[model samples]
Structure formats: C-alpha cells, structure tokens
Target: MYNDKVMKSALESMMFVWGEPLKVKDAAEVLDADKKVVKDLFLDLQREYAMMGRGIRIREVDGAFQFVTHAENEIFIEKLCTPVKVKKLSQAALEVLAIIAYRQPVTKGEIDSIRGIKSERVIDGLMSKDLVDVAGRSEGVGRPLLYKTTGEFLKKFGFASIKDLPDITEFDDIEEYDEETPHEQLSINFEGDADSEDK
Candidate 1:
C-alpha cells in the first residue's frame, strides 16, 4: 500500500518533528521507499507549497530539507515573536568565514595559509552558527576534511547561491602552512555590537 499522498503527508509531519534539515536518505529509509522517489516527492511538495503560496515552505540546504516560513512573512513573524539578543561574531571569526566562503571545500591547513593563522576555533564557531560544515575528505596529504558554506549562510548573506558572491582579486603568493607551527595561532579578538540597520 504505497501511497504518494499518504507518504507526503507523513513526510511533512516528519519534517515538523525533525526541526533541523532532514536528510532525504533518512526520510527514504523511514518510508521504506526509494531515495529518488522520496526526493521527487519532496520537490513536488516544494513546488506545491510555492504554487499555493503557503506561509510555511520547505527549504533545501545542501542535500537536507527543512520547513521554513515564507520570506515575505518575516515581518509578521518578527512582530509576533519577542526580539532575542543575538550572539556576536569576532573579527577573527568573520575573517575565517570570508576565507571559507570564497575558497570553500578548503581544509584548515589551506585556511591557515590564506589568513596566516590557525582557524580551528573560528571554524568551530562558524559550525556552531550553522554557517559552514564539512563537505568531505580531500585526497591530498593526510586526507583532511574539506569545509564549505551552508544554506543558512546564503539566507543570512541574502545570496541565492555561492556563485552570487562578488568577484575579488584572489589572494596572491599564499604560503603553505608548515605542519609544526604555521603562523602562530594568533586570534584577533574584537567584538562589537551590531548596528540597528544591520541584520
């Protein structure tokens, strides 16, 4: 008794329960359905929600899916909810974020090279903020984990995709980080309150 309608309904409930982006494979496994079938159904639901202009919409981040409010309805939601204090990002964090955004799927070693400092803490902070995540393992050297920006990054930056990022002259003559002590782990600690105009 495989029913598209029932499965879709179940999927919606599942997404509601899974607050974070739910991976397609997980949904497929739960439904005992083929991965492609589940994915197509998810796409179908996405279109239906948009076509009908629903207040709640499904958003795909990376390969996972989650429910999100319609962008146009943000004002109303903002007014309804109490304004929560936002966490601040240090200058060091911002610098590391920029490097990762521009040269994504990059390793910590490569990031250290571009910024001339260890970025372990900054990267961890970005991961906590849901701005970036590990993409996969690289083949070079010790097969380090590759990092890339997340969909939340796009939502925060108001970019449809990474390709929309403004072009800039790439960093020149970047040095390779030496394993022992590549640029002492210096941290730029500067935290400033956000202006009223900024998001």
Candidate 2:
C-alpha cells in the first residue's frame, strides 16, 4: 500500500519523466491506487508546487496534469530561446533531419536503409534539440517509433508549413539530398560542440 507521501513522490516523478500531461485515471492505474486518491494527491502537489515559488508548476488541462513553467518566467524562457542559433546542423544531423522532414512518419529502419548507416545517435541529437519528435509507432514487426520534424523545425527552416517544402519534383532524387560531403561540418552557437560526424 502507498502512503500519501510515497504516492505524491511517485506522481511527481511520473509527470516529470513523461514531460506531458497525464490523466488522473491513468496515474491511478500506474500507481495502483484509487482514482479519487490520486486526484486528491495530485491536487495537494499542485498547491505545494505553487507555494514553492519555483520556475515550474503543475497544472491541470482538460482533466490531465502536466508540469509547466510558471507564467511569470515566460520572459526569461523567451530570452533563452531567442539566442538559439539557426544554422548549427552537422552533415549527419542535416541528412537525418532532411530525411525526417521529407519522409516522416518514417521509422529508424527506413532511415538507416536510406542513409546506409545506423542513425540512432544523430536521431537522438535531433530529438534533444527539439527538432524531431516521435510521430507514432509503426505497425511493422517491431513497432518501431516513427519520427517527424516538429513545428520548431518549420520555424527554423523558414517553412510556413510542411506543405511549403520544395516540391519533390525539384529534387532529382531524395537520396541525392543525403549526399553531402562526409567532412562537411556546421556547429550551433548555443551547444558549443564539435560538428556531428557522418558515422
């Protein structure tokens, strides 16, 4: 049996790890507790986070709970986001990004076949930068996750939307877009790291 304190800790951990809103009933199922109890505990957490005067707070939206930055911190958040450079793509990350942008809801396996190398790391980097997201899981044998460029990708690439991408007919071949020189390098100012390798 979960005590109130333990259940509160578990709820907070789940919300943080998920990084998204979770339904009360869903939290209850994961916690193996009563829904009413989970709801009450979550409410208590909401009040506690509010009183802490921290940069983050938990909020309920449409009956789901998520941790969000406090409204008072929006200015600082925007300032931080504003400094992110636009042209930091490495040759490998660029190739993988292009593939995701064009061939999305594509799976890792498909990307590997197209590029002829394992791209798990490059994909991870893109995800860390918030450019790529899991669109869904494929119905294939392994149910691998499908990747897609996020709205941030559109903003960075100066595309009004995915439909604004250059027409497919414009490129003689999709693979050709992935054929940049292996040694080509680009670095982002914010991340201060060496250019990504094509490995």
Candidate 3:
C-alpha cells in the first residue's frame, strides 16, 4: 500500500516540519512506510536535488539526518542570510572562557588560581551572556560550584561540541595580552576604574 511518490512527499513534509534532522526510520514511521522505502526515496530525492542545482542537500551526522546548504555554495547562502555580529568579549571574560573551555566542570576557586584573581564578576557576566552554565558541584571541600560551557557557546564558536576545542598543552601558548596588567601578563586589576569609582 506504500506508494513511492506519496512516501517521498511525506518525507519532504517531515523534513519541513522537523527543521532539524529526520532519521530514515523516524521519517518512515511518521509516514507509516517501510524504512527501506524511505531510504530509497531519500536517495532519489538527494540525486534529483543535485541534478536540479538545488542550493540545499541532506546530510547524515552520527545517526541523525538533516538538510543543509551545499558546502560549495556556503558563501552565496551566507550573503543571502542575515548577518549576525558577535560582541567581542573582554580580556577577563576571554580568560574565564579559556579556563572553562580547557578545565571544564572546574570551580571558581580553580579559575581564580589559574588567572590569579577572583572571577566572580566575570563568571556572572559569562553566565548572563549564556556562554556558561552551572555544570554541577565538585566532590571536594565545601562542594564549590562548577562551571561549563553551554550549547550556546558551541553555536557561537561554531563548534558541534566542546571536544572540538583546540588543544592547549602549555599555559604559555595561551594569549597573554590583557590590557589591565602592567606587563600585559595575567595579573589581577582589582583597583581598575570601576573599583576606583566605588572608593
């Protein structure tokens, strides 16, 4: 009873509705058709799209499938898409981000040691920006709060996961151009303009 044309139409409908990814089995179940039939339909559609000079194509990642623009046409697609400018994070914020990226699920105290200063304000700012989140509590003394990057961070940085972060074996390799420091090192600027205004 599974009409191939009807099944292909149903798969397209599912893709439009999902807007994320549609696995072959999931799409088949939604359309009440055989998985193999859905797979064949998908392959046919993919070939047809390529032949017809479509801007988009279907891709499978892990076990999930989704529609994406052709890599070769990305520049043209981007021009058509809305341009989003990301705000440049401050040095303190970037330091905090780097620490969380490398030593994830780390506590504020640990971050303070790595950067040699208190990071409560910077951490709060990152949290407010939705770049980081409370991962969990450490199983150490006082059970301090631990922080980790969120999916928003990955999306902003164009990473699918934190595992995609570049490796940093030596601390010296990290950027050392914080303006608040005397020699552009990682020294804390507790008496900066903001603190001076408060006094």
Best by TM-score: 1
Better of 1 and 2 by lDDT: 1
- 63-182: candidate 3 lDDT, tens digit per residue: 345565665665565587696553557878878887887788999999999889999999999999898899999999999999998765644453445665655565554645344322
In model 2, which regions exceed 4 Å deviation?
1-87, 170-172, 175-199
Show model 3 residue runs off by greater than 4 Å: 1-85, 172-199
lDDT of 3 at 64: 42
Candidate 2 lDDT, tens digit per residue, 154-178? 4444343577665565322654545
Better of 1 and 2 by TM-score: 1
Q: Report clash pairs, candidate 3.
A: none
Specify the poorest-scoring 10-residue window by lDDT in model 1.
189-198
Clashing pairs in 1: none
Q: Identify the candidate with maximal lDDT.
A: 1
Which lDDT values do the candidates have, in the order given?
A: 0.72, 0.71, 0.67
Relative to the true structure, candidate 2 reaches a TM of: 0.46
C-alpha positional error of residue 41 in candidate 2 after TM-score superposition, expressed in Å: 44
Report the lDDT tens digits of candidate 1 across residue range 1-199: 4799999998899999998778899999999999899999999998898899788888765576777777667667668879766565676777687777777889999989878889999999899989889999999989999999887775555444577665545434223333312111212111211111111
Candidate achieving higher lDDT, 2 or 3: 2
